[model samples]
Target chain A: MSSEAMVVGVVGGGQLARMLHQAAISLGVRVVVLDPDAGCSAALAGAERFDGTWTSAEDLVAFSRSGVDVVTFDHELTDPADLRVLERESPVPVRPGPATKLLAQDKLHARTTFAARGLPVPAFAEVATAEDVAAFAGEHGWPVVLKARRGGYDGRGVWILADRDAAATVLADAEGIPGFLVEELVDLAAEVSVMVARRPSGERRAWPTFVTTQVDGICTEVILGGDAGPAGLAERARELALDLAEQAGLTGVMAVELFVTRDGELRINELACRPHNSGHVTMDSCVTDQFEQHLRAVLDLPLGAPDPLVDAAVMVNVLGGPDPWDREGLTDALAVEDATLHLYGKGHRPGRKLGHVNAVGATVEQARTRARAVADALGSP
Target chain B: MSSEAMVVGVVGGGQLARMLHQAAISLGVRVVVLDPDAGCSAALAGAERFDGTWTSAEDLVAFSRSGVDVVTFDHELTDPADLRVLERESPVPVRPGPATKLLAQDKLHARTTFAARGLPVPAFAEVATAEDVAAFAGEHGWPVVLKARRGGYDGRGVWILADRDAAATVLADAEGIPGFLVEELVDLAAEVSVMVARRPSGERRAWPTFVTTQVDGICTEVILGGDAGPAGLAERARELALDLAEQAGLTGVMAVELFVTRDGELRINELACRPHNSGHVTMDSCVTDQFEQHLRAVLDLPLGAPDPLVDAAVMVNVLGGPDPWDREGLTDALAVEDATLHLYGKGHRPGRKLGHVNAVGATVEQARTRARAVADALGSP
Candidate 1:
């Protein structure tokens, strides 16, 4: 009912920020994107572009003075120290603050904090050398997982080692990568993610737990009403995500990615302090999508219902392919009735995310089949 | 499916253009708005602003050369003669062309065309003086409706003259007004509208018929599955709308406003070349909202399905109130679950359209009740 429009400054201008910009129009809000790339995807969507990077405190200060009511990040690459400096120097409110964002930016910090809070997470230890990894593997067993504590994504920062000799080789190969951590590699059954939005006023809501399929360390597909994994796993995932949101004082959308072991134990894998790819299905199937919810959370507005609009829905990401970018099969893909396609307006690169397609149907299998077909069509030459 | 992003040039920067800009993001298209007002609602949504008016041929030429693939109008105020000149000078294709747009811009032309085509329209005649109005009234009876040929919106260009004396006074006061047409006032019933999207390639689709409630000639609310007027009136309205779209060679969304007579006969009332207020409910209830459909039609892409996602939906317009714009009751309005609010980022003036609220429910009455409550809250002091 208010005619007052709020300007939200986002630190990154990727697809998440692009979607947030789109969602803000209906809410009468303005999004100012601060990305070094002049042609970032969000900027293409008409976001007020400010040429800046995550590490530039001077740029953040200038953006704060440019009338942004609140500042949030599209990615967790911003250094907590830089954010703190911005918070102290600028008048704009930094949502989810540095402390909360750090839990997502640093894997070791999240694992340690969740472990200390009596939450279920993989057994992990800081790995300074091959011996540290060997020691951890000796206690946990062979085939342990090694991960870089920061700046690792899409399986790039992680390695699975079979023995102490393999650990030494991996450690040697990862010479320049900083902040290594070793963890037990559990016998996994499946992977699932839960998205939660929390406002500064403490109001929080969680979307339904959904299953995610990963290929080469990147999410390829997500299905709602996921394969009824361990009897109570879904409920537990929702509870854990909500509990973490409350404990972390999260002031926007956060996703908790979890691994379901063969023995039915649920363990937290990682956290994303922004809208995650696993929730893209919500765009077409839920009463309120995650991007809109993220804006509401940061703006401290009342959360909307997260109920599903259809019986089942699935989303498939269209990764860049070996062939050059072309819409050769787009007409055929669009012929798959009821399937919604969203192109990110980005240049093509092998294995890079180009866009996503969502399909809702009477059953999950039907939705997944239609969604995959459309995504395959989009990726084909 | 082409990777080439299409740039759409819109001639107005009002709420319709704002919504179109929002819709373009998902389609991976770009919208360039040409409006003289830098602070127009669409410009605030991040549309590329052209900083010019529709009447300026130089601006139109520059916009076309700036890489806009197609040009469209959000309002009917653009003179057809000006558009003709621009079309001859610019390479960009102007959708609906000048001829189709003229039908909506000039009432006399539309009435004459539809009548010549043997369409069901009220008996009407051109009136240039008080004697002409008196002569038309002598034949069609008293209490006839008079409408300006151009530049009228809401209730501004229309008047109901009761007798010869009133007609004389009205014509005397109408000194410099443009062309006028006097028509027989139809007997009471209900008013409804049907929206259709037509592509240049001959593809056409229509949404379900709905009823509109008007206050002082401005739409206040629209309800889907309108009052069960005649047994088959809805079907007939759809047929007529589609027929008109094809007959006019329409290349975008066109709304056919119709009057349902007490005898179950449908009569043409007016036409809107762009997204109409009566179709706002489609944003929440239909598979494809009108704005997206408009873009699809103009681009010659496959039109999305118009099936309803819910059993019924209602949309209520939020008119500016006596009090200054404030968010005093926004929280309360948002508390109504499942109701979505869309605010146009425009400065408020009394009687101006500020926003709209939409609600979906099991029945039209139930949805209308909730939508009206939210709209009332938004307009309250």
Candidate 2:
């Protein structure tokens, strides 16, 4: 019955893939996930599976060759070499192609690329030895940020050094690891993210900029469509994001995380080539959600309107609580009628993200209050 | 990992079940379908299958016993006796229980029951022979409607007779049918439908009445939140529907199809005990869609808000066309970005319901115009 239907193969069976599968079903499209775990999160969503590890070139190539019209990703964790092999051997194309992924998978590469394209980024340089760290800090500042070039996500592989002692402690701890980058830490202000989707046909659309809240370097909240900043800042943020998408040759949704200094200067912080936590607000607030737009872009279909449908929408993350399970908390969370809750169906692990609550209102404060209440009621049990 | 999760078993695995599975996935709930056709529409949505038939008591009982927390339905086509058997033999509860389903299954039972409860219905009588139809017509009018007591849907098993000869022809054609009903052909100024979701706890929520357009007997379009009628007519329709739901002891979503006569009277026409076609507009317009609401109602979860999120939402059905398949038409239809399209993964069959398009706007006319354009562009392939 689906002989002529479009099929997309996703690299990781995570929450992003689960949502992609959900969005695809309404359009009569099929999503197949490739993952090593047979019971990954996307499996609960009933996504078809191709059992394989993203780290292996053989697995990547086989999955790409298996009946899918296009290949995509839930995360940028696949090995660059493996993706290169898949690109050369498989008939299907891998979206957000290997080159763009390198710009996400390798922080140093992303920093260099953004800087080269006239995108504002912090002063940065590669450093490995004690002398290297000291020389960079001497030029920039004493307190600096240390980051690994690859294999980092969700606050992992990152260290903030305040002074000599802190810098020495981190350098000693990272004895043998090779790739490293150091950057000057700027004065704290606010954090924001802009998500944009690009199609292979050069069509691109951007969701409005969202102000985000971070706890321990993890996104805790995202507020969309509220002009809580200086005039023209959001518009400039969108322009920067769209320009980055074009420069990276992006073919799917990409989240451009940015930092606003105390003096109102915007600097690029990080890049995620797939759906990011910040885009969750679009699930309820925008005409086209990030997940659906990602699918449309990968399938080479017309991009959906990225404009907000409501005045404001807020999304609050739900982390696993201290208890083994809290069925009552789940019920209580759902009772917040104005909010929409999404549980990822993963088993509880304290401090781990398990779900999120979204609410839309006439103002950012109203939506944020409702979302916060739902998240609090869903407190770790 | 999901040993504590809730599972719902659906009696039919059609488009309704497909959408239920899609909705449940976001809430960490699982939906299992019992259908003889392993490749039913719900299967495309990744719903688990029970490998049974709705018409078989053994199949239903075994499915209900298969570790499900609740047993629900996609359509009212399940055999009432089979449902009763499952209720008596299985541990799970059957929502929209056997008693309520009997009213939807048998036209005579629904008419007599509605009339007995002081609800308005056209003058109707049981008819099994030519004399029965003729005698009822003589009292009511020359033109009447002949309907089977059971097994009728989408214009099937119904006949409009203008004279004695026409009534005689229908009586002859329905020779083996054991039961039938004859009703006065009331002058219909408009057709409307109101959908209500009732939990086993007696908590009921109703969607606003929708003005629907029908081609033959199939609903072709639905418009919500339009004040096109006399003052207070929509509110009255909702009250009547809520009252009927209570009278039927409904435990799930029920669509009350009604006829607004030229004489300014509201009369119930037909009863659907599961998600009905008219409620499709809620999928995009209301805060709580019928599919998700049906799952929540059956699961006995706190009901979500049912108010409209937009000023207006319109849905237009897409029928299959002359060609074997029209991928180009599908693309053209989707290019109408203002409308959201849902295409059931069914093979081409001329005049068959292929899918639907839903659009929300500032006005009913605007939404309807966009929806109609999508449906027209998706013209039969």
Model 2 DockQ vs. reference: 0.53
Task: Please state the CAPRI-style docking class of candidate 2.
Answer: medium
Q: What is the lDDT of residue B80 in candidate 2?
A: 72
Error of 1 at A53 (Å): 1.4
**Tens-digit per-residue lDDT, B1-381, candidate 2:** 222568989998998899899888878899999998877889977999999788889888899899999999988887777878888998988898999998888899999988998889999999878898889988988788999998899988888998888888888887667589999998988889999988887888899899988888889889997763677888899999998889899988999999988876898999999888999898877777888888888888777777777778899987876654466666666667667878777766779887788887788889888888777776642
Question: Candidates' DockQ values?
Answer: 0.52, 0.53
In Å, residue A48's CA in model 1 sits off its true spot by: 1.1
What is the iRMSD of the candidate numbered 1? 2.2
Task: Please tell me which predicted candidate would have the highest DockQ against the true structure.
Answer: 2
Candidate 1 lDDT over A148-222, as tens digits, reads 988888888888988888878877877667688999998889999999999998999999998998887888889
In TM-score terms, which candidate is top?
Answer: 2
Off by over 4 Å in 1: A1-4, A230-232, B1-4, B138-140, B225-228
